[model samples]
Target: MKTTIAVLGAGSWGSVLASVLVQNGHQVRLWTRHPQQAAELNNQHTNQHYMGDYQYPPQLQTLTNLAAVLKNAEVVLFTVPTPAIRSVAEQVVPILHAQKACPLIVHASKGLEQQTHLRISEILTATIPAPYRQEIVALSGPSHAEEVARKDITLITAASTSLAAAQQVQRLFMNNYFRVYTNTDLIGVELGAAFKNVIALGAGALHGLGYGDDAKAALMTRGLAEISRLGVALGAQPLTFIGLSGVGDLIVTCTSIHSRNWRAGNQLGQGKKLTAVIKDMGMVIEGIKTCQSAYELARAQNIDMPITEAIYHVLYEQADIKQEITALMQREGKSESY
Candidate 1:
C-alpha cells in the first residue's frame, strides 16, 4: 500500500527519510523553508549542503507551500531542529484543520526545548491542537542520516503512548536495511535520543583531547548511566534506557565521526572557542542546546547528571575542557551500577 508522507524539513535526516519512504513505495513530499533549496532538491535531486553525494529518489517531491505539503497527507514527519518545532507546529495545524485531516505526527528530532526542558513529543503534544493530539509519535535511535542515506542497515524505535500509532510508523519506515521497532515508552526513547548527543560531544571531546579508546568507553558507559538515571527520574521505564533508543543510540552518536555533536565536541576539545565552533559547524548541534535544557531539568528534578553538567559548563561557561574532564574524573567515586 502506498502512503503519502509529508516531511516537514529537508535537512539530512528529513531528506534521507523521505527517500526511504519513496523506496517503500510511498509518495513523499519534502518541504524546506527556502524556496531555492526546494528547487535545488527537486531539480538537482540532491541536497548538497546536508547530503553531499546521496541522490534523492525521483519519486520524492520538494515543495515550499506548507498547505500543499500537508494536503491529503496520511503522515507528517517532523524532522526540523528542536527549536523550530513549536513554531512549525503552530503554523501547520491551521492548515491541517482547514483540510479536516488528521494524520499521524511522527517526530525524529532529538532535543529538549530550552526553557521548558520538555521532550520533543511533549512539546508537540502541548502545541498540537486537541483533535490530533493522540496521533503523536517519536521516532528515534542510533541511526545516522548519512548511513541511512546510503541504505545502510539501521534500526530505530517508534514510540507513542498509543501503541497503534507507534506501530503505524513502525510499518511505514520498516524495510530490509531499515528496521523499526515499536515502543510505548515515549519518554525513554526521546530522552535517550536527546541525551546521547550530549554524551557524544563528551566522547568526541575526549578523543579530541588526545584520549584513547579507554577514555571514550568510560565516558560512554558512565554517560548511559546518567541518561538512564535522568530517564527514570522523568517517569520513563529504566529498562528503556538499555534498548535501542538508549544504549544503541549512545554507542553510535558517541563513536561516529558522522555525529555533528561529536564533531562539535571534537573541535571544542581541540581548543576552539564555542563561538568559533558554532560558526565553523554550519549545522544545528542539538547537544549544545540540549545540554542547557538537560542541566536545567536535572537541577529542577534533583537528578544527578554530572557528565551533562560538565559538558554544559564547557559549552556555556567556557569551562576548560581538560579541567572539566579532570573534575569529572576526580569526583568522589561511587558504585558503578546505575
Candidate 2:
C-alpha cells in the first residue's frame, strides 16, 4: 500500500528520507523553504543543495507550498533543524483542520533550542492542538544520512508516548537495508540523539590532535557516562543510553568522516577559529550548537556534565583547546563505574 508522506525540509537528511520513501513505493512530497530549490527538484528530479548526486523519482513532488503538500498527508515528517522547528510548527497549526483525519507527525531533528531550551517533541505538543498531540513521534538513531542515502544497511529507532504509534512507524519504514525499531522512551531517545553530537565534536578534536585510539576511546566512554548521568537525572531511563540511540549514535557520529560535527571539531582542534570551522564545513553542525544548549540545560537542571561544559567553553568562551584537554585530564579521579 502506498502512503502519502510530506517531508518538511529538503536538506540532506530530508532528501535522503524522501528518496527512501519513494523506494518503499510511497508518494513523497518534499517541501523546501527555498522556492528555487523546490523548482530544481520538481523539474530536475535532483536536489543540488543536498543530495546532488542521487537521483529521485520523477513522481516525487517538490513543492514550496506547505499547505498543498500537507493537505492529505498520511504521515508528516519534519526534518528541519531544531532552531526552526517552533516557528514551522506554529505556522502549520492553523492549517491542521478537523474535517480531515489527522496524520502522524514525526520529527527527525536532533537538538534542543538554546533560547527556549525545549526539545523537538515538546515544541510540537505545545504548538499543535491536543487532538494531534498523541500522533507526534521522534525518529532517530545512529543512521547517517550520507550512508542511508546510499542504500547502505542502517538501523534506527522510532520513539513515541504510545507504543502503538512507535510500532506504526516501525512497520511503515522498516526495509531490508533500513531497519526500524520501536521504543517508548522518548526522553532517552531524544536526549541521547541530541547530546551525542556534542560528544562527537570532542571525539573529532581528539583525532585532529593526533591522539591515539586509546585516547579517543576514553573520551567516548567518559562522554557516554556524562550523557547517561544527565539523561537519567532528567527522567530518562539510565540504560537507554546503552541502546541504539545512545552508544550507537555516539560511535557513528564521532568516528565518521562524513559527520559535519566531527569534521567541524577536527578543524577546531587543528587551531582554526569557530567561525572559520563552520564556514569551511559548509553544513549545519548540530553538535556545536547543541553543546551550548546542553551546557545551559545542565546548569538549569543542576546536573554535572564536564565534557559538555568543556566543549561549551571551547565553542563560546574562546578557551584554548590544549588547556581544555589538560583541564579534563587533571580532574580528580573517581570510581570507573557511574
Candidate 3:
C-alpha cells in the first residue's frame, strides 16, 4: 500500500507535500534542481532553505537527478512554479518514456504558462509522451503549505481525466490531517487554482488600503465574477469556480497572512514598489506573473474582467489605483445576473 512518489521542486509547498506523503507511509523521493540542497535533505532530513525547522521522515530519499527519481517513481508530482515548468518538462521528457506503461503524473503547482496560456495539466499533456499524458492529473485547493506542513486539517481536490486517477492521488496524499477530494473537472480546478492568486493580490491590496469589510467583500465577490467569466471562456464549468478550488481558495489566499500573493500585494498597497516587495518576500509570488498573464488572456479572449483589468493596469501600465477603483464603481450598471 506504499506509493513511491517523486516530488519535484523544493519550495515550501513541495517539501510539505513530500512530508505529507512520507507520513502517509509512502516512499518519497524529493527532487530539487540543486544537488547540494538534495544532499542536505538526504543527510539532515531538513530543507534549510524552505522548511528549515521541520523535520522529515528518515525514510524520505532526496535526489537532484530527475532520471534517478523518476525511474522508479510510481507517481511524479510537480511542485515547481508555473514559469519553471517548461524547462523542467524538457529536461524530463526523455526519461518519461519509461513511464509509458501505467504512469501517474500529478501536478501540484498552480498557475498557467504565461506564453502558452496553458494550465499545468496542459503543459504535461503537450510535453509528456502520449501514454503518460493520459495519466496527467492536478491536485489543488485552499490549503496553504504552512498550515498543511504543521499537520493541520486541510482539504484539496485531485482532478484528472480518469476517476481512478483522482482516487490514486486521494490514496497517495490523504492523511489524518489532510483530506483529498476527487473531481473530473480538470479545466475548472486548474483555472480556479491559477486565477485565485491574482484575485488574492487584489484583495490584499484592498486590505492594505484600509478598506472596510464591505469593500473587501465586494472585491472578493467581484473577483469570483472575473474568475468565472474568464474560466467559462476557457471551457470551465461555471459552477466549478464556486467550489473549494475557486471561492474557497480565494477566501483563504485573500485573507490569510500566510499567503505570499496577499502579502506581496499588501506591501505594494502600502506604497512599496513591486521589486522591493518581491525582494523582501524572498520567494516566488505567483500573482505578479499571473496578473500579467491573466491580463493578456482576457484581452485575447475578449472577456471583460474589470477587476483583473484594473490590477493589470496598476501593476503594468502605471495606472492610478484610486482612479481604477473609481472607474470600477462607475461602470455602467446592469442586472446582477450575468
Question: What is the overall TM-score of model 2 with all chains considered together?
Answer: 0.96
- What's the residue-level lDDT of 293 in candidate 1? 83
Q: Could you tell me every candidate's TM-score relative to the true structure? A: 0.98, 0.96, 0.96
> All candidates' lDDT scores?
0.90, 0.87, 0.86
**Considering only N, C-alpha and C atoms within 3 Å, which residue pairs clash in candidate 2?**
none
| Candidate 3 ranges with C-alpha deviation above 4 Å | 98-102, 132-134
lDDT of 1 by residue, 1-338 (tens): 88998999999999999999999999899989998889888888989999986889887899999999988999999999999999999998899889888888999999999888888888888888778544789999988999998889999999999999999999998999999999999888999999889999999898889999999899998999999988899899999999999999999999998999999999988888989988999999999999888898889889888999999888889789899888988999788884
lDDT winner among the candidates? 1
Residue 145, model 2, lDDT:
80
Across residues 259-326, which tens digit of lDDT does each residue of candidate 3 receive? 99999878877778887888999998888888888899999999888899899988888777778889
Native-referenced Cα lDDT, model 2: 0.87
Best by TM-score: 1
Candidates 1 and 3, the one with greater TM-score = 1
Sort by lDDT, best first: what order? 1, 2, 3
